[model samples]
Target: MAEIVLANVSKSYGAVPVIEDVSLAIGSGEFVVFLGPSGSGKSTLLRMIAGLETIDSGTLTIGGQRCEQLPPGQRGVAMVFQNYAIYPHMTVRENMAFGLRNINLPQAEIASRVADAARILEIGALLDRRPAELSGGQRQRVAIGRAIVKEPRAFLFDEPLSNLDAALRVRTRVELAELHQRLRSTMIYVTHDQTEAMTLADRIVILNERRIEQIGTPLEVYMRPVSRFVASFVGSPAMNFLEVDVSRRGAERLVTLPSGAALPVPIDLPNDGRYELGVRPENLRVVPSGGDLVGEAVIIERLGDRTLIHVRLADGRSLTAQDSGRSNVAPGDRVALGIDRAEMHLFDASGRAWHPAQAQAVRATETA
Candidate 1:
């Protein structure tokens, strides 16, 4: 099995810590992505698993073998970096065969491995071409082919597609997914792009401030974020936030928005004075009036299929709501927004999320 396990792994450069007390268990053949903003230690964590970086404290086991004390070459893992890392002078075939030659593999065996990798990466036609003659995507495929020839227990990719243009990035991302399906090998990828994480990963590990903030499938984190950081970071256009007051009206829990509209929340919270209301842009629609909140449209983005209306409330808070593509709303127009109550999330003072369904289930269990 190619499963990897890390126990309380902590790493630091002198006094400043990078990854601290991080533990994870990656199942065999799993495609896991480390996702976060820059300097969030996602790449560092991947490097640790690849044996490129040392951990100050913890144990790392890869494919059932302890590897923290081993050197990178000894670890049964291959890494592909952000840059293609292919040599300018060497042809694609030579670049892929270099490592095997270093280990003194027989010439015939090396040629067979290179040919198989080229077939797998669909770069056989470019086998004799140097890096300079290849496109950015081609060079990246060569880099992956080099790792594939190693046939390592696991593959680690560090933003390998970041160098490509938008279109190439999308194409290469699909190729990577197909590669994983064919190989069924454990793969760990690192990237700051949430789209890549959402599309490529079987599970996403979101790192924040040198530690993991959340880990789950893309939809899990998108639909039921555990905290404000996740709810704000995972979604495009982002989740809107507004400070709201809470009160218990008989048996119903109500939240008062800045627009003076009172809405009922399913989850029964504590004697709440204040909480943050989080609603995604897609969860809101342009309404005429008497909605959850009313605001003035400050900006309108016509994005083909859907339009985004940025509204500014009287209290100076801004929110973005989605409208029809042919929306007649214009900038500075008075626009009201209706929210999806089931998709609403509440964040307490500590930024912890209280999902209605989860909280309702817990409440039932508590009284059971």
Candidate 2:
């Protein structure tokens, strides 16, 4: 296992730059994930680390060695692609052992490594089967087995589970987590799936428009996003946003929503600035009457365990709130929504977040 570091790395396609100056340090034996939407340069950045793509500028270091100039074969890394690139003509055993043939290793050593990898992956019984005779999940295991036989310093994955069925994907995801614990190898995974990143990563690097947005643990990014983009992207049912005006009353901050509700939040704000209020669906509550946020339930999604109510405010703005699974409210019903002022998020016009302090200040006096 080895630590990987990218120092001000950059890449481009002719005149169109894909990755800007980005620096990150992945500790040894860590399971890091690169997560983003399509065209977010996540895959391109992973390729640069694997030496599959050229780094237009900056340096990449692995195991304390500068390796940006090294060829892929010379860099100690193994890559697993989206499609399980196993040779259809070769048996599972042969496919896993093919890479060792040119390395001048003894035949017995190669067989031992192949046997060990198959055993660890629970594919020992299918070693003699060709790729055509195996299932998709099995084929992916063989691909991973081939990488394991190389015993590289680090492993890189590019959406390795995208091709599996949903059920199989979940199972494989658990197996991968177990495998990481067993091997404790350094791994960098790239995916557009937030679920995969949340479940598999020690740290998540959120990328947007070829730049890193926020790098944090899943909970950190979810709970205290540094920017408006992250707050909107990390959660399942995205957070709700509403334009609001900010004012300072003594030492407290007051926010006036378009719905004419004045909410005293636990965050410091400039006396005058364009700000918006953000609240997660789970934090917003639907009340029978006299809620701070008055709205009509335009859409109700019953998810069995919980219900999501899309409420259209009087001012024509909309927000969603998660309610109990047993909620009997239906669409077209008039309801009141209440929010925890302490849980609110304030974002400036520039999409920057203003976090509340740990110690709560005195509440602002009532405003007309």
Candidate 3:
């Protein structure tokens, strides 16, 4: 296993830049995921690491060796593509052994490596079957086994489970997590799916238009997003953002909603002229009358275990809140809402988080 480092690395096609001055360190034996929407440079960045795309500037080092100039085969990295890329006519064993054979390894050694990989992937029984005969998930496993047999210093996965059905995707996700635990190799995965990034990564790198937005553990990014973009992108149902004017009520700062209602400030926010109040659905509670915020329930989504309420406030801004699945509230019901002061987040005009004291003061005012 090896640590991968990128220092001011960038990629561009002519004048159109795909990745811009991206620098990051992936530690040895770490599972790091690159997460973003399509055209967000996530896959482009992954390909740059695999040497499938040329870097316009900067350096890439793997295991302490500069690899920007090295060919992919010599980088000591193996990549599993989204398409599986298995040979239709080749058996699983043959597909796994093909790379080793091309390098003129001894027959016995190639066979041993292939066998070991198949056993680890739990596909030994299917070794003699051709790609066409195997299921989609099985074929994908063969593709991974092919990479495993190479024994590279690191593994790169480009949306490896995107092609599978929902049930199969979940199963393969678990299998990949198990594989990482057993191999303990440095892995870099790229995906547009937040669920995949949250579940598999030791750290998630949030990428936006050619730049890194935030890098942190799953819970860190979810609970304490540094930017409004991350706050809205990282969670299911996303966080609710309401534009508010920051005004002082006595000595404390209060956020005035568009509807002319004021909520207590929990955090000490800069008396900045403008700000946004961010509250996650899970942090907002349906309360009896006299709560800090009031909204009319516009839509209700009832999942088996939980319900999501899309509420339209008096000012026309909408917010979603999570509730117990047994909640009996129907559309058109006016409900009072309480936001957990500790869970409230405040963003400045530039969308960055304000100081904790500012946040706490806002919460305190709202609760008061």
Candidate 4:
């Protein structure tokens, strides 16, 4: 396995820069995911590591060797694409063995490698089938198997599951997690899907514009986002942001909603000026009358075990709360919403967040 490192790396098209001064160290045998929206340079960054995109400045090192100028074939990395780039005319076994032949390995060695990869991927039964005869998930497994046959130091997956159906995606995702655990190979996966980033990554690198926003674990990014953009972009149904006034009384911080209701929060207050309160849907609860904030439910989304209530406050701000699945709240109904102070996030005018004491300490350490 190899530890991949990028030091102040940058890329640009003429005067338009795509990636700017990004430095990251992906540990050996670690699974790190590059997560961002379209045009966020995640795929570009992955390609840079693969030698498909040239690094304009700084360094790219793999296994302690500088590889910014190395050819893709010599980088000791295998990449799986979103399209599952396998040969349609070749059988699964042929497709996997094709890459090995070019390396001048003995035929028996190539067969052994292909057989081992097929066993690992549990696709030995499909080895005789052509790409045309395989399901999308099976074809993707074949693509992955081809990479495995190379026995590269690391694996690069670019939205590998994006092409699968929902159920197949779920299954393939589980298989991938198992593969990582089994091989313990260094892997860098790029995707815009938050679910993939959240579930698959040992650490996630969130990119925005031409820079990285944050790097942390799934729960860390979800609960302690360093910026407003990180908090809003990493969660499903997104986080609800409300303009709030904060005041300090002794050691406690009191957050006052626009409706004039005050709730004591565990976070420390920043200096004067309004802060945005970020609460995930799961952390917001609906009360009857006399809740902290009063609003009218404008939309209700029921998803089996949970119900999402989108409420419009008196001041015209909207908030979504996750309620009980059996709760009978409907649109047009008056609902009182309470914020989970313990789970809330406070974002300053600059979009930087102040999390709970535990998270703040960790954030401070990272900065230090």
Candidate 5:
């Protein structure tokens, strides 16, 4: 019963608030990721859960026991840090056994725990090596092994893969996922990398400016973002924003772009002032002739299998569209982008997002 809950938990550094009125429940044996850019307080939130930082205004409970005022060791959570916090002066075995030794556990139990963790992390062969002698990935595994010996209720990881090389990072990320499946332990990982969050977490908690913007499964957040900030931040190339006017003409709901091109998007709106049309690069297609949107190719990014075309619209704003690797479209070439209504997202002045399906459902309900 390692379920964790935070009820109106918040933290502040003087007058500056880091985490404010955040409440969430993490099911036992679930893998959750805190994702956001630097200074967004993802790590701070994780630290709060770890008891390294004091909670300012709310209560935290781990496995149904209040832990906000508890010491980190008493909170029933183990943390693996970005810096492999394992002692460099000690061998891998010694580093993994250090915490157990501090508690004056039976020498046999300490040795058994250390041996089991090493075997689980596949570092049993390197148990006698110091941190300097081991590779970055191996050292990180040692750090994790140190945490595993505690048999805590949950695990906390703060950008543990950041120090590894790109290839190694990918490899280690997969290893972590496998390890989670093996242990089925409640793990809360903190990372700014969306790729890591998308691939690793069962659910992602997206934070921005010291506040949580959204929390959902990867596909849910990717397919249906709640706000413009979320839509823009979650994807690789990010969502494109085009200023447009929404108005009702007869029975047709139209979105008039800056270039006077109208997209017939039948969605519920006030049809007042300017709104932002959100579309992803993959949703926009480069057509041969006239399309829903017209633009000129200003940049062509050629990856191995795909080419990304940066289309500069008539209004001077640019958008990224995907094309095949063999695409002959060059810079300065005239191109038009086609988009489907179902794939489009509309954002009001307040930055709230609405999809075609959601809007139609709302309209149907209103008319009913």
Candidate 6:
């Protein structure tokens, strides 16, 4: 296992920039995932690390060695691609041994490595079968097994589970996590799926528009996003945002919504200005009596475990709240909703985040 580092890394095709000034350090034996939208440069960054794409500027270091200029073979990294690139006519054993054979390793050594990889991947039983006869998940395992037999210093995966069905994807995800645990090698995985990123990564790198937005554990980003973009991008139902005006209510600051309901926020304002208030669906509760906000339920979606309520506020802004699945709330009900003061998020005019202490202060003064 080795550490990977990128300093001021960038990529471009003529005048169009794909990635820009991205710097990150991946610890040795750590699993890092690059997550973003389709055009967000996640794949481009992965390719740069694998030496498939040239870095227009910046430095890349792998295992304490400068590797930006090295060829893919000399970089000591093995890649598992999305297509499960296996020769259909060759048996799994022959497929896994092909790379080693090209380098002219001793016959005994090649057999030992292939056998060890097949055993590790639990593909020893199917070693003699051709790729045409294997299931999607099994074929992917073969691709990974091929990488393992190379005995690389690190592993790079580019959407390796995309071809599998939903059930197979989950199973393969678990297997990949176990493989990392057993090998304890540095692995960089790229995927556009947020669920995959949340479940698989030790730390997630969120990229957007040729730049990185934030890098943190899944819960950290979900609980306290540093920007409005991250707050909206990281959550499943996405965060709810409403525009409000800030005002001084006695010694404390309060945010008055367009609906004329004033919410005590825990933040200090330089002046009465416009800002966006963010709340997660789980943080908003349906109240039996009264609340600081009132809205009409526009839609209700009931999942097995939870119910999602989409409420259109008096001012015509919409917000969603999550309730217990067993709770019977129908569409078109006039529902009162309360915000959990401790779980609120406030953003400045520029979309940058404010500390929670500010939000707490506002809530305290309002309650007082």
Q: How high is the lDDT of residue 95 in model 3?
A: 96
lDDT of 1 by residue, 47-115 (tens): 999888998899999989999999999999999999988899999999999999999999999999999
- Report the C-alpha lDDT of model 2 over 152-249, residue by residue, as the tens digit: 99999999999999999999999999999999999999998889999999999999999999999988888888899999988888999988888877
lDDT tens digits, residue span 135-204, model 5: 9999999999999999999999999999999999999999999999999999999998999999999999
Model 5 misplacement above 4 A: 360-368
lDDT of every model, 2 decimals: 0.92, 0.91, 0.90, 0.92, 0.91, 0.90
The per-residue C-alpha lDDT of model 4 at residue 248 equals: 79
Cα RMSD for predicted model 6: 3.5
Worst 10 residues of 5 by lDDT: 265-274
> What is the alpha-carbon lDDT for the whole of candidate 4?
0.92
Which candidate number has the best TM-score?
A: 1
Evaluate residue 240 in candidate 2 and report its C-alpha lDDT on the 0 to 100 scale.
95
* Candidate 4 colliding pairs: none
Per-prediction TM-score, please?
A: 0.98, 0.95, 0.94, 0.96, 0.96, 0.94
lDDT of 6: 0.90
Consecutive 10-residue window with the lowest summed lDDT within model 3: 353-362
Candidate 2 segments exceeding 4 Å error: 357-368
How do the candidates rank by TM-score, highest first? Answer: 1, 5, 4, 2, 3, 6
Clashing pairs in 6: 265-362, 266-358, 266-359, 266-361, 266-362, 267-358
lDDT of 3 by residue, 301-356 (tens): 99979889999988788889878889988999998887777787888878797645
Candidate 4 per-residue C-alpha lDDT over 1-368 given as tens digits, one digit per residue, 9 for 90 to 100: 99999999999999999999999999999999999989999999999999999999999999999999999999999999999999888999999999999889999999999999999999999999999999999999999999999999999999999989999999999999999999999999999999998999999999999899999999899888999999999999999998989987777678888988888886655485589989999999997667778889999999989999999988888988989999899889999887777898889988988878755676687799
Q: Root-mean-square deviation of each candidate, in angstroms? A: 1.1, 3.8, 3.6, 2.2, 1.5, 3.5
Give the Cα-based TM-score of candidate 1 against the true structure.
0.98
TM match of model 2 to true structure:
0.95
Q: What clash pairs does model 1 have? A: none
Better of 1 and 5 by lDDT: 1
